[model samples]
Target: MTSLLLYFLLGIISAIIGALPLGAVNLAVIRATTTQTILNAFYIILTAGVGEILLATLALYYNIELSHFFTQHPWVQGSFIFTFFFIGIYLLFIKNKINTKNYPKLHTSKLITGFSLATLNPPVAIYWILAISWIDKYIFELTPHTSFVSLLLFFFGIYLGKTTTLYCYGLWGHKIAQQKNSKTKLSRILGVALIILSIFQGIKFIAE
Candidate 1:
């Protein structure tokens, strides 16, 4: 019981610290909250948390092997590049305004959108690997079972933290939407940001 409590506490702290930084997943959550219901935003955060757990698990168990594989795999790099570009194009070309009253239902389910967006992001996997390495070096010992439990709790904390942050952003968005004709402005800003992220991803891919 003591061991479990310690691990769980560590998990929460680590995940909260890690998630404080802004990133693509954070942006997506904010976007979802702005356009969809808070429940839908939670769905996005839940799936993203699941993705984090999977990545952290893989990092804990097979860090060295996976690192080598990712380094060697051109296809993996290509896939990331293509995915970013595709998403960027899609967002950039989105003509319809994303107002709550007239928000068109997306073809993709929120669950799938959240999962795929989080999972396909190469940085998340790399971040997990690095985070695991740090935890192994500085924190508690990581046996197979302990690593699993700890990371599970950690990602749960991440989900909670992320949800909180996105909800705040959602409220901010809601305020803006209530102002004179701001939904279109918000959508345009998000679209441009995604496009910029895509460009950065492409450059990073080439540099790597």
Candidate 2:
């Protein structure tokens, strides 16, 4: 039981730390919160959490198979490049109405938007594989041979930690959004950060 608890705690700590970085998932959560209500942003958080755990689970059990799949499919990688470049461009220059008076209703299901944001990146699986390997080496020894109950605990902890980290970001966004004068400024800052991040992703693809 103590061993199982360790697995779960490891999952929580790892996820919280992992989600702290500025990336697609947390950016989307921060965007949602800043644009709308904190509660609505949580709709994105819940589904995004689901998507993150799904990717982590696949990577944990099928690291080699997934690695081969990404290598074999050039189109999948191409899509990520296109997506990053497109989003970067859009955010950098696109002018849209910012209605700070009232939160706008999302046309799409917040859940679907969040899930797609989390799941579309194929390389995130690789991150999980690398992260798990590092954790296994220095933190604890986890393997494909790990017991099912422990894996379950770990996954659930991942879900919880991911959402919690995102919620913290949501709170930050809410605080910024609450500032009546900063909506446009926030958009510009987020746009620049996203563009930089996307460029970094492109550079990583080339380097790898």
Candidate 3:
């Protein structure tokens, strides 16, 4: 019972930390809520959570090997840096060509959008790898049985945290969409945040 509680807590904490940052997934969720229905946004977040679960499972299974590999090939970090940088630049500079007047019909299906977005983002994989490493170092002993049970709890927590956070963002975005010229402002804010995060990650990579 204590081990279960500890694993659950670790999952909750790690997931909250991972999702707290403003990233493509959160921004996408917010945007979906703003332009579409909250239900649609929920679907998107749910699918993204599924993706995270898969990644977390894989990371737990190969924690030691992945940690060693990441340590040896630091260039893999560059994928995360470049992805965020590109997204920041695109969001900051690229003008939206889509007509907002047709927003109802313009959006893609939430499940597909979420799955594709999560799959394409390398940072999510990196996050899981680091999370597993942290768990191994500071959390409970990760024997085969413990690892399976702990990671199962951890992924469940991740899904809960992610869905909760995105739901909050969805609600906030839905509210904010009622204001005048709010979407543009939100886009700019997300863009800047992504750029800042990219730089932060770059520095952390170098320091490590």
Candidate 4:
């Protein structure tokens, strides 16, 4: 019983660590703002948390040296930056192709978006490696068997934190939408932010 409680605590901590940033998922939710946007973003963020949980679990159990791979083949980081850059370009230029009017109202697809954002981003992978290493040290001192369980708890916490953050964004969007402000201006601002961030990440990747 005490062991189970410990695992729960671990999950909470890891989730908080994993979900604190405004990355692609947050950008997507920001772009998709509507009456249903917050709920959709919540599910998206939840699935992303699940993906991180799985990755952390696999690395700890399999003894995968993710950091080593990342440091050695730094091009992998470039790929993620490229992906982000391409996404920003697409969002900025070809958004009309999405046919928002014909888009499905269902929330199930939100999970897919979340998973991709969490699993595919280079920073997310790096974050997990750092987070898992920290967790590994702490748990190995206690009991190796429980480390993975702790990561699972951390995953849940990440989703909880991310969902809460997105929910707040949704509320803000709703409030802002009620005003006469331009959504196009908001989107352009988001697009520029993504482009600049991606370029910075890409430059850092190449430098390392």
TM-score list, all predictions: 0.69, 0.84, 0.83, 0.70
For candidate 3, write residues 1-208 as lDDT tens digits. Answer: 7887787777777777777887777888988877777888888898887776776777777777867877888777688787888887776767354456855655578898877776566567778787777677776664356756765776688888777777888898888888888777667767788899999989988887
Error of 3 at 29 (Å): 0.3
Colliding residue pairs in candidate 1: none
Score residue 206 of candidate 4 by CA lDDT: 67
| lDDT measured at residue 35 in model 1 versus the true structure, 0 to 100 | 65
lDDT digits (tens) for residues 11-117 of candidate 1: 55655655554456666776665666667767777787666667667787888987887788857766765665665565556644334566675566777777777
RMSD of 1: 4.3
The segments of candidate 4 whose C-alpha lies over 4 angstroms from its true place after superposition are 1-14, 89-108, 135-144, 147-152
Name the lDDT of candidate 1.
0.65
Models, CA RMSD each: 4.3, 3.1, 3.0, 4.4
Candidate 2, RMSD to the unseen true structure: 3.1
Deviation from native of the Cα of residue 42 in model 2, angstroms: 1.0
lDDT of 2 by residue, 1-208 (tens): 8988998998888788777766677777777788778887899999988988988888888877887887788678767766766766666667445333577754888889889988876656667877887877787767778888988899888899889999998888888888876666676667777677667867877787
lDDT of each: 0.65, 0.79, 0.76, 0.64
lDDT of 4: 0.64
Q: After superposition, how far is residue 67 of candidate 3 from its true place, in Å?
A: 3.6
lDDT of model 1, residue 90: 58
Clashes of each: 0, 0, 0, 5
> What's the ranking of the predictions by lDDT, best on top?
2, 3, 1, 4
Candidate 3 runs further than 4 Å off: 68-76, 96-107, 147-150
Question: Which ranges in model 1 have alpha carbons more than 4 Å from their true place?
Answer: 1-10, 13-28, 85-108, 143-155, 202-204
